[model samples]
Target: MKIPIAIVGCGGMGGRHLLGLKELASSDMNNITLSAVCDLRRDNAEHLADDAEELLGSRPLVFDDMKRMAEAMPDLQAVDITTDARAHHLVASTALDLGLHVLCEKPLALTIRGCNRILTAQKRSGKYLSVAENYRRDPMSRLTKALLDAGSIGRPELFMDISASSGNQIIITPWRHKKNMGGMLLDGGVHNADMMLYYLGDIDQVYARIALWEKTRYRPEGDGAVSGFYQRWFGEMPESIEATAEDTLTAVVNFNNGTMGQWTQSYAAHGRGFGHKVIYGSAGSLRPGGTRNGAPPVLAHDGQDEITGSPLLDLVPDFHLDAITSNLFGADRLASYDIPFPAADRKLLAIELYELAACVLNGTSPEVDGFVGRRAEALCYAAFESSVLNRPVSLDEIESEQVGSYEAEINEELKL
Candidate 1:
């Protein structure tokens, strides 16, 4: 079954989706056909259309408006909504009403209310919808999750995921600095939030402290005439820029299962870095001892002879996701529930998009559906509120109150 689909927003991420879709169509498992590509800018949309034609031997229709795209291609089965976070709800709602399934980019929407708008539309339309969160879909992440589930760690008690980087970390994008889209914590942090949710489960409460360590503004500073490449500005030399987002954040979370999790984000770490993911469990501890992806996850047990699995023997670095995928989809069909995504290279984004396409084709719920996306987003937004209120915000507090401070600001600013 082929799922005819159009891609919206032909910018950075949208372009990636275009490539993935083309790859999926050309692959042996070929299941999705790219029918059209859309961008707010015509040139961007047309450029991807040309690439699609070159890759697939047929040009996809191009449109500046999504409704126009759908109207133009009445047979379009679904849309890969790769627009900005703020525009996700509006675009998805329109597509949902038009009876198109949606595979939206992360955060689903900036505010909880905004997210619910898409959910309501999906409920009314009965269309398949999923959020493309690819972090946890990566091979390494999946391997870690498997080990945890296999009892390698023996009841994880605590987990710490930290990322410390230099330059291009803080100024993710010009609009990100302006805070039109969320910020570092919500915009970039949504991936972290999803990863946390994958391992730690639901968060019961969150307490956070946020900071704006490096106040930045988009400025033209290149050659004396201001003609140098600026990575922070997405290779653009904007004359002026304003900031409203928090760049540094630290948060502690209490899970409903009585486990604790901590997350820290800092864009101001210019040189030396300290970053790692360590899960301290009752029976064993795991630390990432090396930088290469080929290195196996380090495991150290407190000499517990009863738990007799050798770490090196158990956690081999060479086992790819393909091994498991091939088994589940090809050999061990009924014995396993794992979906064999076609990309043997373990391209996480392609895996995620393939999952969405599979759902639309086979009539199954996506692994990361809209509800999962919203819950992860809620954690990020709730962390924002916790930072402001200087206390742990319970999940019930977020559920009881229809609109939190962050949600209110987003609705007011974006007029959602």
Candidate 2:
């Protein structure tokens, strides 16, 4: 029996997920029936419903509210939430209360407490909760982990994850610039935090200086081209907007395993923007590629030839994509791929959807469960707390609620 599922919040991310569902339906691992698409905006719901009809060969029921959808379709077993960062807890907890398993987009929630609210609700309802972290699911990420475990780079000692964008353009949407809505940092930084955790083990403490370098961001005038995947989901924009979210961060991350790394990112950078995620070890260093799009991992070993491309695959002979991922992406053991952005993105989303179905059918836990999501989110908060207090903050302090001065306002606003 196919699990009956729905995609909620029919905005940009929701549109991407619809594309992903289409990809999943075409794959052998397709298991969930997209029973509905819900959104507060009726037009958005109807727009995706029309797309679902054309793409999936059947129109899903459209709803302006999720509760009404649940009441209308009692068999609805799962919901994939693509709402804004702030709405995750409300929507996810509601879905869990409706007895539906959930697959929520990353960060899990705006605040750790918000994440816990959804988690506590999941615990009470005994439903599976998955965090849609596509980065770690990338084949390159898997291979990188395999190589690290195989000691291709020897003992991990230092990691440098740096990203800088030079501009004051509105990032994605307007709400992303608002602190109440989780701003640009937590909105995108969760992926970084998750990647850091994926590469290095648990983070111990964070010391940082975070700043809102861009007080105002201008919306692209006329039809100015935007960046990357966001262009696909661009919509109407305001001419100018006041930005509340901090746009710059430079932090030192101390890992539990004694591995230390620098995490620096700035959208307000003025000079040539640069970005890279490289880990240097005793023997060599590795430059990881971007997620989903099958970029090859780069490795340089001491007194040995630099290895990359297909040859990098030799380092981890036992490394291979899971059965589902292998079939979906059509490469089980390749080190690099040429699949384009949104296409590759859809495949990763299909993998996430397929995993959700497996958990529902096989009674299993999701690889990126609620707790895993919380840990990633807490690291971002730890940085924020550290920045506010002007001192190093432990992940334990942030997780245990001992140091949440940074997120107190967000938590209070949400009533979490």
Worst 10 residues of 1 by lDDT: 328-337
> Which residue runs does candidate 2 get wrong by more than 4 Å?
222-224, 227-235
lDDT score, candidate 2: 0.88
Cα deviation in Å at residue 391, candidate 2?
1.1
Tens-place lDDT digits, model 1, residues 26-95: 5577678888888898887887788788878999888998887788888998999888788898999999
Can you list the residue pairs that collide in candidate 2? none
Assess candidate 1 and give its lDDT: 0.71
lDDT scores for all predictions? 0.71, 0.88
Cα lDDT of model 2 by residue, 27-104, tens digit: 877898999999998888898899899999999999999999999999899999998888999999999999999999
lDDT at 80, model 2: 96
Best lDDT goes to which candidate?
A: 2
Give the Å error, residue 270, model 2.
Answer: 2.4
User: What TM-scores do the predictions have?
Assistant: 0.85, 0.97
